[model samples]
Target: MEFFTIKPCKTQAAYVVEPKKPLHLDLKALKVPFDITARTPVLMAMRIDGVDVSLYPSGKMLIQCDEPECIAKKVWGEVA
Candidate 1:
């Protein structure tokens, strides 16, 4: 599990989505816990079923095995 990029906005966090490969299925985003603020930028890249999807900030990501355990993975991240 790698990361893309993390950007922030005034009211909401900004996220960029760029899949390493083209994906058209369901993915699971794990919102891991972190000390950073909720509004902080988070970059993440998930390999779901051999596919990657770019998740925008505040956007929703599908989960794989089980859901993440915290807010860290919940927030959207940029896809690099």
Candidate 2:
């Protein structure tokens, strides 16, 4: 199955990536290298390459950058 579906954001230079099914992620336990700017029970916001990235427990991500697809691939890796 496809790991995620990607679409460009209508109001910004960004992309939204979402999994086919909900993914329960522990925001407090994520080991991402980016500096997290905000955190809550349901969301984690970080900065990467001078842009904003918002992660959700439901396997949805909003990435604002010039190459969002590339960043998404690197973040989630090769999922079958």
What are the Cα lDDT values of the candidates?
A: 0.34, 0.75
lDDT tens digits by residue: candidate 2, 22-51: 778888777777778998879988877787
Candidate 1 per-residue lDDT, tens place, 1-80, comes to 23333333234333332233443332234353332222223434545343333333444343332222122243333221
Q: What's the TM-score of each model vs. the native?
A: 0.23, 0.75
- Best TM-score goes to which candidate? 2
- The clash count for each model shown is 13, 0
Task: Flag regions of model 1 displaced more than 4 Å.
Answer: 1-42, 60-80
Model 1 — TM-score against the truth? 0.23
